[model samples]
Target: MPKLLLLEAMGNTGEYILDAARHLNAEIIVVTHEDVHEDWYSPTLKAKIAEYGKLVFADFSDSEGALRQLKELARAEGVDGVVAGWEFLTPLVARLAADLGLPGNDPTRSLSCRNKRIMARAFTEHGIPAPRTVAARDLGEAYTLVRSAGLTYPVVVKPSEQSGSWGVSVVSDDEELADAFVVAQSHIFQMPHGIPLDPHVIIQEYVGGTEFSIETVAVRGAVTPLFPYDKFTTGGAKRAEYGHTVPAELDAAQVAVLQEAAVAAARAVGITNGVAHTELKLLPDGTTRIIELGARLPGDHVVALMRQARGIDEARIYVQIALGQEPVLTPTADTAAGIRFLTPPRGGTLRSVTGLGDCDAVALSKMTVPPGGRVRAPGDNDSRVGYVILHADTAAEVNAAAAQVLANVSIEVV
Candidate 1:
């Protein structure tokens, strides 16, 4: 059995990774801050860890110190592989794996995968198709840089290092840009571990197109790109993802465009091994731009959706890649799956949510928020209150059922 070192199991991806470990008969040793493990980890994750894994506590805020501690622990544990359960820790994972003489991404360029400013520079240097982005330390600098970049209004202002679209906004003018800048600057650190973040903000020329995601796997520097999926995000200033359809409805040529962009991005970011969850935009001009990429598994229960749709267990594949084993990518089924988030009309105190009808295609419907919980407006992924997952024989059928299922649902918030 291969022993794996997982750096912080915090999201749905972590849960799925732990569950996959069980099926593979692998031993998992998770490293996280003690406080975060207590506060953020779900009971199910804790139980899974208790069953076949061990937990180690370290202060990730001190990156060097944490790396030292983890290195010693890795040696003692006789770990065979390392995986970043969170995107922010990709750099550290690279460093750890490199120090252990294990297969992993290039440690020197790992920061390019996490910091947008660095990632933009990498893309520019590599000639990767990406949005024209410039970084700034303040509003004045932002204005200067945006003009210098030859970017126009309706630009995107966001933190240099944040996930889930947390401080991202589309601004149409200078005043809106100023407002968005402060919001982006406010995200100065990552929580739970108190990890410091880049103080600069990125002012990027907005790419107008349909967004899609592709999951790519690499082993011993060889890449295998998966099918591109529909990343259904709401368009506006917020760009919150409301739904996702597996096997995005697109022709072979279109899929090739997305997958090529994704693979190029993964390679540019030094993702020589393990998995990359890449997001891209297909412009109206029959071209695509690399939006961003995560050197880890796809988030938002996508692991579940992929399995239901293609019978491709990405979670399992991720584990195999980390262990330097050939990933099992052959499809076991030909189907489709989708997930739609339930959101209130606006931000308010939650009162009630009803009218979720049990349609045949509906596989699971769940409310994550309870009554009286304060809810934010649907601005980002965090604003979601609940979600429903559906499945069918094809993407069209799944999407059709999704529309019908969501149309009948009602959410009431005071």
Candidate 2:
């Protein structure tokens, strides 16, 4: 069995990875901070580790120190591969894999996969079609740089490195910029490990269009961009991802356009031996803008959705890629699946959610938080109170089923 070191098993991706690891019968070593393992890890995650793996705590806040400690553990444990369970720790995982001479992406260009500031620069250098972006350390500098770059108002303000759409905002003018910049800069560290983040905020020219995501798999520099999928997000000052539909309804030419852009961005970020979850926008004129790429398995339960739609187990493929093995990327199914997040009308004490019908297409449906649980408004990914997964014969059918659920559901909050 291949021994794999999984960095930070915290999200749904972590659970999927663990399941894949068990299926592959790989020896898994999960790493996290002691505090995080106690406070952030779920009981189910802890149970998974207890069943077939070992857990190790490291101070990820100190990158160098953590690297040293993990290096020793990896050597002693005879780890054959390294995988990133959290998007924030992709860089560290790359560095570890490269140092150990294992299958992984290039360490030199790995930050482009995680840090938006560095990723913007990398995209520009590669001539990837992306939103024009400028980084700012403070609001004063933001004003200077944005104006100097000839960027107008209504730009996007986001932290240099973050997930879940946290601290991401669409600002119209200078005052809005100030507010958005404060929120962006306040995200100075990542959770579960307290890893320090780049304090710069990225001001990007807004690209208006339909947004979609393409999940890509690569091995030894060979990239295979899969079909595009619908990535739904709320519109307003804050963009929050509400749901996703797999096997996006697109023509052959349209899928070609998205696949071409996705492959370029994945290779640009050094995804030579791993999986990438890339987001992009398709303009009315058919042009596409690469949003960003993550060098890890996708979160938001996209793994499960993909498996249901295409019968491709991306989490398993990720492990195989890390172990220097070729993955079977063939589609075993031609169905479709979608997930709709239950978003409260506003933020308050959750009272009750009703009207979820037991439809045949509904594969899974339940509330993540119970009644009386504190729930935030639909601002970011974390604000979701529950979700429903549905599968059907086609994308249109799946989308129609999800729409029915959305239309009938009522989220009551005090």
Candidate 3:
């Protein structure tokens, strides 16, 4: 069996990738910090990885050291493919794949896929449709650039290197820009491995309209577009995603537009192989602007939803592409799936959740953060206490069921 080396199997996508590797009969080796595996990983994740294949520990913060160690491990373990289960390590994934001569993206420009400033440059260079953005190292520079660029109010301020809407805010004016900049630059190191991150902040013209995400599977420069999904973000300064509905309710023309934009965005960032999760916004004028794209699988259990709705396993496709094999993109069903995150009304100790059994269409209900655990305010992905996954024959039904589940579910936070 071909052995695949995966980086950081601790996120939601990790389990799905493990399941996919098993389905493909591929041996899997997960590389992560030993402490992370011991501390942050759940019992289920640990057990699953142990049962599936080997687990290798590495220091992700030290990029060069980890790369060298991974090279040695790959050679010794006879690893045939390398994939990244985390978004922040996309560059590392490309570099490792290139070192092994495996199927992957362009290592030379892989940083563009991680850093927003670099990604904006790549998009501009490739003439990709994206928002006009400016990077600033400090507040003074941001103010100067904002005025000179003639950027209007309600612009987006975000960290150059962050995910899940962390440290992202929409500023309505100059007064709000400074606070947003601080939040954007507050993060200095990433979790699990303590990897140092870029301190710079990016200010972009907010692309106003509905937001959507598309997943693409690429093999040897061939890109296959998966079903697009609707992204529901909070309408406020902090654009935290509330949920997602699969097979986004869009007309054929709109779907085509989204697919084309997704492909262009993927190619702009040099995604030759593997999967890309791309986010876009449809403007009022019927045009679309690329918000961002990651050289990894979609989060929020999107892979599971896709499988439940259409019988298509995106995780399987990702592994197949990494293994230099053809991916299965054909959908067997036309159903719809939705997931709604249960956020606490206020930041406090969680008491209990009720009314979980009131929904008939609810397929699975999971409370990630248990009672007595402290919960943060609903601003980013970290604040979600639990989630409800629903499945139905039609998009309306799926949406209705998700809404009902959210309405009935009561989270008591002290």
Candidates in order have lDDT scores of 0.90, 0.92, 0.90
Give the CA lDDT, 0 to 100, for residue 63 in model 2. 92
Per-model clash counts, in order, read 0, 0, 0
TM for every model, in the order presented, reads 0.98, 0.98, 0.98
Best by lDDT: 2
Order of candidate numbers by lDDT, starting with the best: 2, 3, 1
Model 3, runs deviating above 4 Å: none
Worst 10 residues of 2 by lDDT: 186-195
What TM-score does prediction 1 earn?
Answer: 0.98
On lDDT, who's better, 2 or 3?
Answer: 2
Output the TM-score of candidate 2.
0.98
Compared with the true structure, what per-residue lDDT tens digits does model 3 show for residues 1-414? 989999988899998889889988999999888899999888999999989879988999999999999999999999989988888888999999999899999999899989999999999999999999999999999999888988998899999999888999998988899999999999889986899998889999988888999998888998878877989999789889989989898888888888999998899899999889999988777789999999999999989989989999989988998898887788999899999999998899999999887677888888989899999998888899999998888888989888777778889999
- Writing each residue's lDDT as its tens digit, candidate 1 over 1-414 gives 899899999998998888888788899999999999999998998998998888999999999999999999999989998988898999999999999998899898899989999999999999999999999999999999988879999999889999898989999999999999999999687997889999999988899888999999888878889999999887788877889999899999999988888888888989888888888999998899998888888888989999999999988888888787888889889899999999888999889888887799999988888999999988888888999999999999999999998889889989
lDDT tens digits, residues 296-333, model 2? 88788889999999999999999998887778999999
